[model samples]
Target: MTEIQAGLTVCTVLVVPYIVQAIKTKAMTGNVARWIAISVSTLCGVLTAMAGGMPTDASAWVTSIFAAVGGVQVAYAAFRSVGVTDKWLDALLALGDIKED
Candidate 1:
């Protein structure tokens, strides 16, 4: 993988789950967390594909998402041993004018 791809892979694989859990504790549900994982994995894969210099098109994005699903998304239960949720996420959402449901 290219440096960008490798780096993004690390962030998606290692850091995203922590953020997701933080969101969960911020009141996002298990279903929300699951979808968040899917969304982040898809984003990582698309960026990975772009970094890898694959075609900058939907087909390539789809291919990359499938491929990266194995490496990018760490299981929620596998790493849910700690709770790191915080108020930072609330501030982040507020910046976007998003209110919790």
Candidate 2:
């Protein structure tokens, strides 16, 4: 896989669980730590994307990808720590839930 895609995959694997927990519990408090982690991960992803250039360089690509993962983890933890319920966070968590149709 390409560097970008690989980075995203790593992030997704790391972040999805916290999101699920937040939605299932509906208690932001429970995910404070995770939100912080995913936030960092997301931030790293953005930075890497902004940095541009080839991802083939093992060192750069690895560091970028690791940062992306950490950012995502931070994001999730931060989202929970915010201690407020909003439509957006709710919607995000709901994405993984069973849609009652």
Candidate 3:
């Protein structure tokens, strides 16, 4: 494998679990710490994906796919922590028909 591929693979191996742990412990660990971890992991994932290049190979794509998923999971967890429910998310989706009555 290429140097870039090897570097990204190592980064993914290290960052993926950190991101998952941050999301899992966000409730007990405080949002600040969790957000810091999430931010770092997000940056690492982006870098890994960029280094991995196009989707021509499995290793090239897994980091990006997993990073995107991790980011979304953290966002959802953040919203849920603040008491934002699925109904609120659906309401946001229906902004054009918002009712004030």
Candidate 4:
């Protein structure tokens, strides 16, 4: 993933969950919406991590992940600035289901 990809991921994370919540509100309970937000957050983190590059392509995969980590850090910082870190965003990583391979 490049910076563009990271930016797109940020936008998707910012928008998709709310859209999902809104469209499915009648059938979607609080717990379901919470899980949807968690899932999108986890996927965005993974997308950003790919900015570090894939393992097969780089021997310095750890370093790449490190480099790309800052992008996610900054994104979370913005989220924090906007007070998006209450229950859902705060638990985003703790509930992340993505696994590095």
Q: Model 1, range 15-42, lDDT digits (tens) per residue?
A: 6666666566547777888788778777
Relative to the unseen true structure, what is the C-alpha lDDT of residue 77 in candidate 4, on a scale of 0 to 100? 52
lDDT of 3 by residue, 1-101 (tens): 45775566455544454444434432655566555555666566656666645457666556564654475455556655664533454455468785788
TM-score preference between candidates 2 and 3, better one? 2
Model 2, residue 2: displacement in angstroms? 18
Quality of model 3 by C-alpha lDDT: 0.55
**Per-residue accuracy of model 2 over 3-97 as CA lDDT, tens digit each:** 76556656664555455554554445645745544665556564565455655557666666566675455554565577433455567666989
Model 4 agreement with the true structure over 1-101: per-residue lDDT tens digits = 56655575657556654444444445778668655655555565555556545446543444334333444445545655676654454456347576679
Off by over 4 Å in 3: 1-53, 84-95, 98-101
Q: Which is superior by TM-score, 1 or 2?
A: 1
Ranking by TM-score: 1, 4, 2, 3
Off by over 4 Å in 4: 55-101
Model 3 has a clash total of 0
Model 3, C-alpha of 96: deviation from truth (Å): 3.4
On a 0 to 1 TM-score scale, where does candidate 4 land against the true structure? 0.41
- TM-score between candidate 2 and the true structure: 0.37
Pairs with steric clashes in candidate 1: none
Candidate 2 has its poorest 10 consecutive residues by lDDT at 17-26
1 or 3: which has the higher lDDT? Answer: 1
**Candidate 4, poorest ten consecutive residues by summed lDDT:** 59-68
